[model samples]
Every structure is written in structure tokens, then in C-alpha cells.
Target: MTSTATTVPAAPGAPAATAASAATGASVAPSARPAPVPLADLVDAGLEVPVLGGRTVRHVNLDLAASAPALTAVAAHVGAVLPYYASVHRGTGYASQASTALLEDARVAVAGRVGARLDDLVVFTRNTTDALNLLASAVPGETVVLDIEHHANLLPWQRRGRRVVVAGPTFGATLDALAAELARRPAALLSVTGASNLTGEVLPLAELADLAHAHGARLAVDAAQLLPHRPVDLAASGIDYLAFSGHKAYAPFGAGALVGRADWLDAAPPHLAGGGAVESVTVDAAEWKTGPERHEAGTPNLIGAVALARALAELERIGEDARRAHEDALAARLHDGLAAQPGVRVLRGFDDLEDRLGIATLELERGSVGLVAAALAAEHGISVRAGRFCAHPFFDRLATRANGLRVSLGAGSSADDVDRFLDALAGLIADGPAFAYDRTPAGWCPRTDDRPRPSFA
Candidate 1:
């Protein structure tokens, strides 16, 4: 099945066509234009790993929601930048000046990629958790959030005044519940996830933004799962703030950003009180710098910022339509295949959710999920996630057992990857693992195994 949607225009300052066309004075006709390059071809597509029974096979990464392998383009860009890497903002050397320029360019790219408004500030952060924590500190009034959020979006708000509304039976009812909460008591912000990490269901941001605005609140979205699969236009959608991680976007260099309005951020005290965050300091007092400088203390992740920017650019070049088509086909296959298995039960948050990414979490009727996850890895070279996935409250409410198995795909995933996982799972469910397994300190492992670790490790 194909996932269909209106083609979203490229954000301001983002590439609208292939890099080759941008370089030369040429225009390619729509009919003659080549298909976007396969995402699998742009990453570590040929990775091989050792499995049980003295065999090695191609590694199938089905755990993209946790962390994705760095795209080859991003890695190449990082390699080119490392030689001249230096501390930014104050050094007089050529390398420092160049590094400073690159960092600022990355900031601009991030802002443009999200369609940030003119007054919005793009603050570099450690990851989504750190970005939300920074926003939590700056928010002036009580925040309203749904109970289905990831812990990163939930925990930070809890530290401040927060109102948690239980999601209703259907997506539409959930929106009504949120509207009711905001009407009952005014909130400064309405925080929510763009896509669910476990169920892969997508939330309608434009509608959510309108709901928040009607209730006199601002909307903030956690787009770690959404950005990889879809394009986000904060300005057009009326989102006041956005947060996402590079690691989840196929740029795993330990970087993230918070893009949003600047008033509250400037009013709040600096997130960290250090050198770069201060404008003037004395023995008795210190004055903090406003904007992004107020929060980015000490040295920043220069390489990470550059890598993230490159990844976003590459995604733009690939185009959203191509990415969606590839992922939609794979997701449909995985979901349908899992549903066909008698022992497997697919999880869902709402009955009315129509759009979702390539993620699925399921429970088995008669096996330890941990053992099955381990068996897939040891015997089939397939990697997946098992456990609470860092959203314990939501997991506890939805799952039948302590945890469930999650299979997620991304830009680098192919149809074969999904098929392999489904086949292995079916075999395991029907006849159990081919090898004896035992619960170890780390989780489950083969009773007698001697698979060699990769030489690099």
C-alpha cells in the first residue's frame, strides 16, 4: 500500500532540487527526472555481522527509533571538517573563524529546515532530552501534555507545574480531551510528540497547533520520530517550538536543537552559567548573554552540528515523496505480516490513527520477548528493541507484560530487512529458537555461543 499526501514545498533556504542542478544552469523536466536515490545506498549498506552456527550475514537494523547508523554522506562531511576543527566565537586564527562560520551556517540551516520564524532562536543541545529540559526551565506557566508522551517530553514538564490529560479511546476524542483541559485551566504551552516512539502513530500538528492557539497556549512538538519520515513546517503549522535529536535522524554525532520563539528564552536565566553564556563578569556580579548564547555554554559540538546540517540537506535532496513511498511499502508488509502470525499481537494507541511511520511493537502469547529479541540477533543477524523503550508509564498502560518487542525502520531500511525479521519471528514462534537460551545479567543469551565480535570492536 502507498502512503499518500499532498507534496509539501521545501522550506525556505532548503534545496528544492538535486545538488547537481543547483550547481549548473540547468532544469530537469518532471517527466525526465530520475527517481530519488535509494536511502540504503547512502549509508553503511554493506555491513556484515556474524550469527550463530558459524555463518556471517548482512546486518539488518530494525531498531532505528533507538539510534540510527550515521549516513555515509554525513560521515564524509565530518571527515572533511575535522582537519580544521577549532573552538568557535573568540579565536583569531583562520580555522576558528571558519569553524565559527560553519557553526552559524548550521544554526541557520536547522532554523530553515523547521521553518522557524524570524525571531525564533535555534539553540544547540545534547539531544532531545536536553532540549526539552531547557524548554522546561524557560516556560513561564503551567504546561499541558498528554499521558502518551515519551519520558523526555513528560519528565521535564513534571518538574514544573504540569497538567497530564489521559488520551481518549480514539484520536478525535483525545483531541477533545486536550481541548477540554485547556479550556478548564489556561496553560502556557501544549507539549506533544509528532509521532509515537512505540506505536509509530502520527499526530496532526496543524490541528494541534490550532487547538493550542484557540485555548491561548503555544504548541511545542517533539519531532525526533517525525522529522525522519516527514517534513515539518513550524511556521505554516503554527508550532511555537520544536525539538529533535540528530542521532535519531541518521546523524548520530550527539547533537540536537530547540527551535522556537525567543521571548521566554531570553527572559529566563541562562541554562548554564559559564564563560560563553556571560556578556560581562566581575567579582560581585555577572550579566548573561541573551538568545542562543545564553544556553550554549562552554565548547559546542561543532562536528555534530555540521553533520546534522548535512543529513538534513541530504534528506531534502532525496525528497519526501520517495522516502514516504519506500517506508510505507515496508511498514505495510511488516504490519500485515505480524498480524497474520497467530501468537503475535500488535499494539496501538488509538483506533482512528491513519498515518504512522515504519514502527511496530508487539507481544507474543507464549515466549519471553527478551529471549526472542536475543535469538533474532544471535541466529539471524537481525537487530530490534525490547523493553519499556524509555516510556514506562505509557508502556505500563498499553502492554500486557513488562515489555514488548519493537521493530522500526528508517531511511537505510529495505524490504528484505522487514521480510527477514518476519520470517525469523514466525520460525521462532512456531518451533522456538534453534538454540538453547538462558537469562543472563544483560538479558537473554544463547546457552553455548561463541560468535566472534567484529574486528573493529
Candidate 2:
């Protein structure tokens, strides 16, 4: 359940970390090597942040699960489309028509990316939390969810009288527990995450879907973490509802989607009661529209949708195989390196690295998690997430300490990035922080703020 990487190098044949060989004694050609990812073309392509002693370094972002850098292709697409943008749905102008077409096309693209059924409805919301909250409102009866889920999936259901099933020791047992709960009662929904935000543990979504369906419950997947790292097929998995965010999917913030069967969504009231949701608004009566328009009451995030579509397309162009190769290599390196480190604990229930995303959370012995994170940023320019990572219950379950450090990999992350973090952690463990830091009410920060301030002007 716990391991450490003493050195930075990964162990040989780490599960899901090695590329498949052709056959016995077959050699791979040099041309077959995966090309380096081209995600550096991000808007802040060469941006650097200040570290300790007034020095600056190019940020090594290892927080992909939280939010990813916008792809260059996506930024370019947004720039090209911005000039001709106008109001969607009702505008009669050329720009409006083009914008409307773009939004519809984006909806199709997102739906296609997740393998949504032909009859499924894709409703755009603020983010995954908003999308899940919308679904929570639509459920007619009690919902069943696990305590290991992120707050986005948990809190919404709690408001709707959800049954919280504490996860068992093993993943199989957890599924069995869910089955037992569903069998015990008639639940309206079975809410779960495609992957754990805290541990990156990929849940058994297919079997879960089968169980939910058999118990007459609809399965809703919060794919904010899974969609970025792995492919999710709603149709194939038999998931009735799915929600994800554009920020985690490599697009700009402020847009997310809830894709699922139309019946529940249609029967529920409009998510918003503004302009576009209504078909007619008389003095005493108001009728609502159906489909996505019902929830997207005001002007929708056309730019966000277009950006998301472009990011998804870029990922598709690069191909999942290549991305997975890159992630596997980096994750293996990070995982093994951290596991080998003395006094470091890798947070997860699984002993192998096969059933995880490119995410690693660690509980350190030498220093506080917040201090370690700050030291990494201030001293070594490595940016990783620290603290609870928005999943209090799961973090409480995994971490023996109050806080933990999280490093998540993505297509943009390089092996060099992983090595830098490992080296930084080793240094911190050996020498402590180079710069003086103080824990503030907000969080830990460098005590010395003598560096020149960045000017927006």
C-alpha cells in the first residue's frame, strides 16, 4: 500500500510504464520512437517564475489534474475565431451564425470524444462541480455514492439524501459494497468518479455501471480527473451520466459539460432561468426549452467551448498511444523515484502501478507538506499541488499526516520535469529549505519578498 523511490530512476518494467514489444527477440526500430510532445507552444510558452534569492526559473508544472496549460493549437484556434464572434442562438448576423455553428460543432466534438450515445444530451455548465450539482437537482430519489469521491461528486448528493458507502479494503470489495447498498434499496442515482482525485485510482466503472443498472439506478461519472489522462467511453461503459471540466481537459476555465440520458435532465427544471432557457415568457407564464439550451440560460461560453474542442482535437491528433507512452514513462520514473526515497510514502491502495493515472501523492517525514511544496517552488521552480487537493475524506483516509504533496503528469510534462522534482525533493530532505519561509493565514510563502513585482501594465 506504501512505497518510496530512493533515487530518481524508475525500476525496470514498471506496470503500464513499458512499451509493448513486437515478439520474443524482436527489436524495435529507431523510427518507432515516440516523438517529443509539442505542448510547449502554450500561450505562456516560455514564462518563468521567481524562486528564492531573486532568481527565476521556467516553471515545471506537475499539477495537470487541477488545470492544464492551454495547447498552442487551442489558443491559435481561439484567436482566429475571436474576431468573428457574436451572440449565439438568436443573432441574425454573419458572426452570430458562425459562432452558433462553432458552439454546435464543439458540442458534437465533446460528445464524440467521450463516446456519448446518439440520444444523450450534453449540457454546458460552469465546471464539473456545477455539472454534478445540476445532476444532483435532477435526481428524483436518493442517490448512492462513496466516501472516497471528490466533494464535487459527494456534496451535491448529500443535499439530495445520498447514501455514503465507506470504501472497503480492496477495489473489488468496494464494488461489492456498492452492489449491496443498491440491492438494499431503490436508488435514483449511483454517483462515482471515473478516477480518484486524491490517489488517481481508476475505479471499476464498467462493473459499477452494470451493478447500478441491475439495481435500477443510473450511474453518473465525475470524469474531471480521468478524461484528461485516459479515454472514457460512456456508451461502452454503460454510464448514464458523465461530467468533466474544460480546464482539466487542457482548455481555459469557465466551461464544463454534463452528458447523459435526456429523460432526467428534461424532467428537471432549468438550471438557470435566464434568456436562452425560456421558449416563451409572458406576464404570468414561462415555458422552458429542451436540451442544453435549458441549462445554458444566459450567453454561453462560446470561447471556452471552442477552446475545449480544439484541445480535444489536438490530443486526438497527437494520439492517445503516444500520450500514454509519455505519461507511462514519466509516471513510472516519478512513482519509483518517490517510492525509493526514505521516509516518503506513496499514497494509494494498489501495490502495482497499473491501475493509476499519472498522479502521485506523497506523505513526507522530514518536512511539512506545505513547506515542501513551497520549497520546491521557491528553490527549484517545481510547481506541485499541496494540501488536501479538494478531497478531504479520501485524503484523510490515505494520508496519516495532515497534508500531502501531489504531482500529476500530462502530455506536456517531460522526464526532465520529473527528475527535477525528484532531485528537489532529495535536496529538501537532505538540506532543508534554502530560503526562509513563514506559514501565513493564506498558506506558506517565502519570507523575503524583495523580488521585483510583475506589472500587468
Candidate 3:
């Protein structure tokens, strides 16, 4: 299951590749590829917690779709830059110059990683929610979106005169409905998720792009889920805009990007109105800068950008072919194992496994999801997310239950983790949880079961 696309060419203005610049650009002299790290080698793999018999087992984290664990490479890059930290774009000091250069270089690195066009502007924001909000604010006319989108993609456009189209029964039919809706009215943008947060099924981006373009609408993809598993090239895919977060891509939390055309973004008023976003301020008004700086009104997150760039660079160094094969194999194993279970139903949008990433959503017939999830955490030391996964509309429309269990994988997930998760689920299905559970305001919690909470030590 290797991807056929080669690594994208470096963006102009990026540092020239050399022997020492192996992690920043694509032109490292051909050498042996770095060996991939297993899930057990991650920073959180050694975590231990008490289970049913009061015995501790290493925690098995199976929640990659929500927020993936930071990669060791990204952490190292953050640590390396600690000494040179400074206020970017303001100070003329030595560290400031270096940090500023790092921030700008990181923008170029991320843009290149996503195959952004030469004219596209990459604006770093807080997360996918913030990025989409910025785009929503900039959209000139009514926006069209699918009902299956994450809340981040769905909520922002509601106030902007949006038209929501409910998906049809089948995937292809859903696209046809969307195309018909786009035809019904003049639209400024058609926003969609690259992959469903619930089912992990990928959308037909190229086809959707063609449909949007044919209907005089620009396509914006919320790639928070897709970027982790596969390649998303803006130029090649004909995507007008792409929004994704750093945490989902093995970078630390707090940074995301909105990369796309400059026309809409430039024409709209600044997303934030103050400080660095301005060219000069008069008593009555202030002049705004064009491009990304126009919206980034505050001091930028230099460290976050550097860490994200390093993570993207590391992914490139590992090669998509190797990463995809590893994830696909584990996904197939997990899917097969789940299918073999008596009452387990693996929720999916498409018939083919290739249309999905390594994510599984399960609906159990015999046990309560809350009890199963709580028992897995307290009695089995396995972690998974059980909920609507932020797509309330999708769940309300398709799922028999409001919530389900989602097990997602990433670069760090290994055969051991997947096996452990399946074993836990099998045990749960064969026999109910050993402990009683109750749903509270927070979520499901153990009832009268007192186990020492694991410390980060």
C-alpha cells in the first residue's frame, strides 16, 4: 500500500539542503532511511496503571484521532530551540533575528509539505477551528457545507449564510447531492472534511474539487484527520484551501494552519485588529498588512511552528510508503479481528478498506459503551475515545446509538498496541466489565471502584 507520489519539491526561500539540513528539506543526499520507531518507544508508552486485581500494566493508548502523542523528533526540535527563543518580528536582537527566520522558514516548510501553490499564503492559527473561522469570516458569499462535518467545520459557517446539505445513503450519492446543491445557488466556498472523524473514511477530494470548480465554488478541506494518514497536495488535488492542526500530525498542541489563495483572505478585513497586523496606525484608523501577517495580529508561536516543521520533515524522511504500509497492515488486522467478534459492528462509510485510514468505530450489541470504555480504562489499562467524536449530525443520522467507541492509529501505533486493544475488546465482549460504571456530568466513571490514579512519574 505504498503511495505513488514523490516528496514535494522544496518551497522557494527555504534553506538550501545540505548534509546538515537533512530534517528541514527533501534534498538530503541519498542515504539509508531512518528506521521507524514503534508505539512502545513513544514518550507515553511506559505509563503504568492499576487494573482489576490491583496489578499495574503498561497503559495502551489507542486514541490517536483525538490528539496524537507528540513525536520524539518534534520534542527534540522544541528542546533544541529553547535557548534561542525570542519575540519574533519585533526585536532586532540576535535571538529575535534567528527566531524570526525560524518562523518564516517553518511557514515555507509546512507550505511545501502540503504542496501549496507558489501564490498560496500559509497562515498559522490556533487549530482547525480557528483556521476555519478565519476562512468563514473571509468568505464573500454564502458557504455550502455537508452535515457530516466536525463541529469545527460545521459551526463556524452557520452564521455566514451557509447552506447545509444532508448526505445521501451511499458515499457517491452524497457527493451527487452536494453537487446538486452547489448547482442550485451561487456559492463562495464548499467546505468539507478530508476524512470523517467518526468512520475515518476519506472523501473523494479530487472529484469534489472538480464539482466545486464546475459550479463556481472554491473547495476548502478540513484535513485535520487526513493529513496524519495520507498525502494532501493543494496544487495536485485542486483544493483551494486546507486547514489542519499540528497536534494531529505528531506536533505539539496549540498550532494549526490555513493554507490557500490570497485573494479572499487579502480582500477581507483582518481576522484580528491590532499590533503586528497593521502597517501603521493613525488616530482614526490603522492600515493592515497583506498576506498572513494581516491576520496574525499578535506575536506568533515560533516554537510551535518549528516543532510542526520538524514533525513534517521527519514524516518526509521516513517516507509515506513505509508509514502507510505499517498503518494499513495494522488496520486490516484490527478490522478482521473486530469483524470476527459476535456483536461488534465496525462502522464504515465505504465498502473498501483502502478508502479509510487506521480508524475503527464500533457499536456493541451486548454491553453499554460507557461501561466498556470505563472498564477498559480502569480494569485493562487500555485507552480509547467513546463518544459522538464531535460529529453530532453524522452520528444522529447514521449511528444506532448517539455514541460509539473509536480506536485510531498513527505513526507510533504498532502491532502490539493493536493486538492489546483487540484483546481487551474481545474480553469485554465475552464477559462484561468487572466493575460497575455510571455516567456523570464529565463522562463515564467507575462506580465505587477506587484505584490509585497514575502519576506522570
Candidate 4:
């Protein structure tokens, strides 16, 4: 179903814009608010790429949900931090002290960004998967989860003996199902995604938190998708724990965080047993430190943390209203345009949901999705994600086929970008791919491919 036909709620404090206005490029009650500026400058804003038939076009990236390109400001911050890169924790040298300060500062900044409580411990990790895995290692008891989760959120809990509740037909029904499971038996934590990575439909955090708390269980949100698109306040929403990745948040230097109350983390053994994690060590026994240092064993991704902090600062400066306004318009246009096509079907988890990110996953009724995705990239210079998206079980239930195409946009996207994608897809649907393609082990590739990779590669 298309979102355009529904009366989706506007971002808080922002005027609503109808699907018609979005399709026709009309302003949303121009007098109601000032016109939005570009959300945030991205590192590769106008990079050119070679398309089929030896033609060049400005690359259009509709795969932000996978791994967003770094913000220009974030890249600059990385350059600034690289000069002082050194080992952290207990180092007396000048560079080490500077790097240590930056890492700790980043912890504070990230915690503040998510409205973390004063007693919360911000543990650094490799990515969202790592963060959730760390939490799974520390959780005191059984966990409850929904079937409509990415594997990172699902498998970790399953390994630790979780109660999996299949999602219901609608979001409300799904909430009820979760409540029923929680009431059936007490769980230590109710782990869920803040938004579905496949459908981009946002879940109500406060409501979920309330349900978990009512059943005497804590809540942990996998905010990998939610944090980058919208704001999250753990304190205000009653969220007990939060996990997210820097890669998805415009800083791709292998860093993420798990922020939550310190009791359980301190109670559990150190995530890794090594130098920085221990206070004192004997040959056979060691005393692990508590708090963040307990889990962070060796050298950390100091530059990555610094870059993430800078990227969050940039997003704050751009303001949430402007970001929401820009993405809302683009998403409406995209969903409405695709739904208008004869063979295209936009995937969604809930029919009654209101808010979503600028992410749309679709399947073609008449053609191979893998082939179409390849054509979009080779012929249109458009980058989108195709396949199971690392959620195979969820995909098997939601899709008729084994895979689908996902087109997602973010801060760097523009009206022109959306229009170009719509036009290109329409053309492809009408005339088929311009060049012949063949299935390869990697995926579908042009039969006689001649595109050249950048020299750096």
C-alpha cells in the first residue's frame, strides 16, 4: 500500500503536507514555517559516475539505509582528529591524553544526544550488531522479541533463550501480542528495533517502553535506523537501553554504542578480557574494571567516536524540523510515484502506521528484482540495495520472492534526485533494461560490462 493515500502525521511542530502537494511540488502552507534549507551537506554530494552506453551522470544514492556517506563536516572532523591519534586510557603522553579526552568527550556527547540518564554507561562497540551482542551477554534473564526484526536484534536474543512473538497484522495488534507474551512470562528485557530496517516504519518507543515496564521488564531499542532519521530521548521515553552504529549515522569508521543503566553491565563479566578492561591482574586471576572501560578492552576507534560526535553536532545545527520536512516530501513523492506503476509494489509492515523514514522497499510483479536492481545501477547510475537485506526470515514472510529492491534517501537527497529516480524507473518498466544482463555469482551484471572503477581502487 502507498503512504500517499493515508493522512500521515507531520513531525511535531511542523505543518503537514499532503501527498498531492508533495507530488506536485507545492509548498506546505508556506506561511506556516520558513522554507527548509538543505538538510546537511554530504561528502560525495555531486560525484559523477559512468552509466551504460559510456554515458556519465551524477550518481544518485538511494541506499542511505545501508551505509550513508559521511557528512562533509564529519569527514573534516576526521581529518582534524587523525593528527592526534594515539592509544587511550592510562597513557601519559600528550597525543594519548588528547585521544583519550576525545573518546570520553564523545561518550558524553552521544549520551547527551539520546537523553541518557546520569547513571547510564556508554559502552563503545564495533557496530550495532556488536552493541546488541554485548547487551545479550549481560542481560540478567530471558528476553522477548518480535519476528519483524533484523537478524542483529533477533539472533543475539535467540542465542540467549528468547521468547519470539510473531508480529500481528497491524502495529497495534503487534503491540498487543508483545504485551500478551510479556504477561505470559516475565522477561528481563524486551528487545526491539526502533524502526523496521526493511519497511522503514517507525515504532512508538514510549508505548513499547510502557508495555515492557508494566510487565516488570526493561526495554532495549536497536536504534540503528531510528537515530539517524529522527530524534530519540531515552529518559523521556522510558527506554532502558539504546544501541546504534556510527556507520549508519554518517560516521563509517567502525564504531557504535550501547547506552544503558550500569547495574547489569557491571554485574556481567567484561565483554573482553585484556589490558584496558582490568584494574589489576595476576597470572591466574584478574579484576575487571566497571563502567565503559570494562567492555572496552584494547585500543578504541578514537577517530570514529570523534567523527560521530561531530556528525551529531552537525545534525543538531541543521535542526530536526528542516530534516523531517525535506525527507517527508521526498518520501511521499517516491512512495506515491512507485505505487502508481503497474507492476511495482511498495512493501510495508503496518497499514495504520503514520511516520516513516525516507526508505521504500519494492518488488516487481513481472521481472527479476535482482536484474532490475542491476539495471538501475548500470543504466541509471543509481545505487539501491537489493536482496534479503540481512533479514532473511522477515523477508521470507513479507515478500513473494526471495529478494526485493530498497530505495532509501537521507540528508543529501534532493527533489531532482527523487524525480530522476521516478523517471528512470518508469522508463525501465515501460521499455525494459537498455542492455542485456546475465546472472553472476556476485549478482546480475551487464552481459558486456565495460564500466571502469576509480583509480584508487
Local accuracy of candidate 1 as per-residue lDDT tens digits, 361-447:
998766678888988999999999999888777778888987899999888887678767877776665556778776767778787
Report lDDT (Cα) of residue 298, candidate 4: 86
Writing each residue's lDDT as its tens digit, candidate 2 over 316-348 gives 777778777777766777777776455678888
Give Cα-based local distance difference scores for all models.
0.85, 0.80, 0.80, 0.83
Per-prediction backbone clash count:
0, 9, 0, 0
Candidate 3 lDDT, tens digit per residue, 394-421? Answer: 8777778757888988888766677677
Q: Could you tell me how far off, in angstroms, the CA of residue 73 lies in candidate 1 after the best superposition?
A: 0.9
User: What TM-score does prediction 4 earn?
Assistant: 0.91
lDDT of 1: 0.85
Highest-lDDT candidate: 1
User: Candidate 2 regions off by >4 Å?
Assistant: 1-41, 350-353
Candidate with better TM-score, 2 vs 4: 4
User: In angstroms, how far off is 143's CA in candidate 3?
Assistant: 1.4
Off by over 4 Å in 1: 1-42
